[model samples]
Target chain A: NSKVIQTPRYLVKGQGQKAKMRCIPEKGHPVVFWYQQNKNNEFKFLINFQNQEVLQQIDMTEKRFSAECPSNSPCSLEIQSSEAGDSALYLCASSLPTGRQDTQYFGPGTRLLVL
Target chain B: AQSVTQPDARVTVSEGASLQLRCKYSYSGTPYLFWYVQYPRQGLQLLLKYYSGDPVVQGVNGFEAEFSKSNSSFHLRKASVHWSDSAVYFCALNSNAKLTFGKGTKLSVKS
Candidate 1:
């Protein structure tokens, strides 16, 4: 069983409302990644962090999504304004530093519904 | 950019029958491949991963995957599947600490 934990198994928000989710990575893991799994089962990489520093992110994340992993705090991803298209399963994964072959352990994920 | 392709979107097999899920990846250099299974309303569980050395890797729940460099494929297989094995299986590629996942294959096992 993975130790990574995510809060709010489900969330419902209307358009223009802000939606936020939190993730607590596994112990001693420094790398955290966020991914969006759509209804069609396509996964899109949103953003990732190495400890408290941003590693990489896509254009969609740069616009409406903001995420951070502060020291001694649960990492969070927040959407400034929710959209119908934003409804999906947000997954958080954590991994130890092992070059490119790091095996990321995933949380149960937060399923968001935007109406 | 590296990408993964799961040729089959859904596969149905009888309980106690053999199983194989095809996966192909496109990348320039050596590839890191992984097989993950997601139960309904749950997170992805790592079935297996292949980086180097042996081409065949064993995973939990009697699952295994073979990494083929010549064919650019990493396919998952199970000798015998149970009804509980039905779920969505995803094949992914790891590059530069990022993962590129296939759309996933929904496995339905009939009892």
Candidate 2:
């Protein structure tokens, strides 16, 4: 019964404004992931961190987004200088120590609207 | 390269009716497949996953998926669908443990 909690369920940012989303992984989970879902119902993986080290990330994340999972603190995904295209639901997920069989638990997601 | 394809963009089924959502994949071998559901305004929830062993695996919410290696498909099915089954279903393929998701199929269960 893993539960991932996210802060500020809703977010609105103007073009070029910064947007930050936070996620508290389930207790003892060491893997965290960030994804962007658009109106088209397509999900794009942004980045993933194993403990405090990043394991994998997409090109889009490297350009506009930065995510970090500091020791014992909630993981944060920050979008710097958000553009109109950056407006989408950003979802955070966490998984237990197991990599293959562990089902990732997701947060409620932070809906970002960049106007 | 690994990918997941859910051909139907939308599906409507009556309550208590049997349901099947088609999902196909393109990978080198038996890949890690998963079915996830997303209710309105909620993040995705895992319904089931298939890694190995039995080709047919049961998941939460009475959902099950069958893996056919020859057909390269992992279709989701339910014996009797409930009205609360209305949601977007996504099929995912993990290549090298990196998740690749499909454009979800929106399922609407009618009363």
Candidate 3:
């Protein structure tokens, strides 16, 4: 089983409200990733971090989303203003990043519902 | 750009029957392929991964995948699937530490 943990398994927010979720990566893992899974089962990669440094992020995330993985603290992803279309499941995964092939372990994910 | 394709959106099979889930990927250089299963309301679980060496790789719960470079495919298979195997299967390619995933295929195993 994966040791990754995500807080607030379910969240409900009104439109234009802020929505935030947190994730705790597995111990000894230095890489973390966040993704959004829609109701249609389509996955979109949002952002990733290696330790406290940002690696990659999408254009949507660059605009409305903010994330950070601080040392000794849980990683967090927050949206400036949640929209109805933003209602989806947010998944967090962690990996060791061996510079070759690395398997990522995922958490249960936080399901967001916008009203 | 890299992309993964799962031809089947849904697949149904009887318990104790063989199974095959087709997957095709598009990438310029060598590709790292992976198969992940997601149960209802749960996160994705890695079934298997293929980097190099053997074309056929074994995974947990009697799952296996065969990689075909010429066909640009990594197809998942199982000898005898149980009802518990019913879930969504995703085919993904790893590039630049990012995962490109297919829409996903929902598998239904009837007992």
Candidate 4:
């Protein structure tokens, strides 16, 4: 299994609360991607990082959702002020530089609920 | 803007039966196509991708997809599906390295 580890299997918080989801990519992978899955099982690509730099980010991600990949610390996506609309499963994936034929390894995901 | 479409929202199939999931996309240039599967309470997993090679691409767990340029479609198929194959499948496109994803199709396998 090309395992990608994510922390905090589940989280529940009130409105305006802050939440953080972490991810550890598979060994040797250099690119990381974050996605948000809503109730309809629809996935929205939030952002992705190539190495330590962010290559692309969606408008929703750039607003309220913040992500960082430090050299020493694990990659993480943090929401500053959580809302009911932010209640969704957050997923992380990592892939090689090739972007072609390189399968992305995904974490199980952290389910967040903002009540 | 780039977009993807998954026609079927949900599909139920019997075990050991053939399966097919339809996907269509709209892009300006040569788009990179991908199929991903997500089990219940799990993350999205990469099944296969097509980025300018043979129109037909094979993926893990005996899944295969054929890309049609004329139709702007990439459909996934399996010869004989197992019970464990039940999950939600998503079709995605990468245009100029930026990604656009479809809603998804939920698959249910019954014994």
Candidate 2 per-residue lDDT, tens place, A1-115, comes to 3399998899998999999989998888898989899999778888888999998888773477888999988999998888998888889988875665567778889999999
Error of 4 at A1 (Å): 3.2
Candidate 3 lDDT, A3-92, residue by residue in tens: 999999999999999999999999999999999999988899999999999989888733778999999999999988998999999999
Q: Which structure among the candidates has the greatest DockQ?
A: 1
Model 1 CA deviation exceeding 4 Å by range: none
- Pairs that collide in candidate 2 are none
User: How does each model score on lDDT?
Assistant: 0.95, 0.88, 0.94, 0.88
Interface RMSD of 2: 1.9
TM-score of chain B of 1: 0.99
Residues A1-115 of candidate 4 have per-residue lDDT tens digits of 6589999989898999999999999888889989888887767788889878998888773388899888767899999999999999998889888854456678999999999
Tens-digit lDDT track of model 2 for B43-95: 88889999899999999988999999999999999999999999999999876
lDDT of 1 by residue, B1-111 (tens): 799999999999999999999999999988999999999999999999999999999999999999999999999999999999999999999988889999999999999
Q: State the lDDT at A38 in candidate 4.
A: 86
> Weakest 10 consecutive residues, lDDT, candidate 2 chain A?
A96-105
Q: What does the lDDT read for residue A90 in candidate 3?
A: 99
Docking class of 4: medium
Q: Comparing to the true complex, what docking class would candidate 2 get?
A: medium
Best by lDDT: 1
Error of 4 at B110 (Å): 1.8
**Runs off by more than 4 Å, candidate 4:** A60-62, A99-102
Q: What is the two-chain DockQ of model 1?
A: 0.90
> Deviation in angstroms for B21 in model 3?
0.4
Cα-based lDDT at residue A61, candidate 2: 32
Write one digit per residue (lDDT tens) for candidate 4, span B1-111.
Answer: 888999899999999999999999998888888998988887778898997779999999999999999999999999999999999999988765555778999999999
Docking class of 3: medium
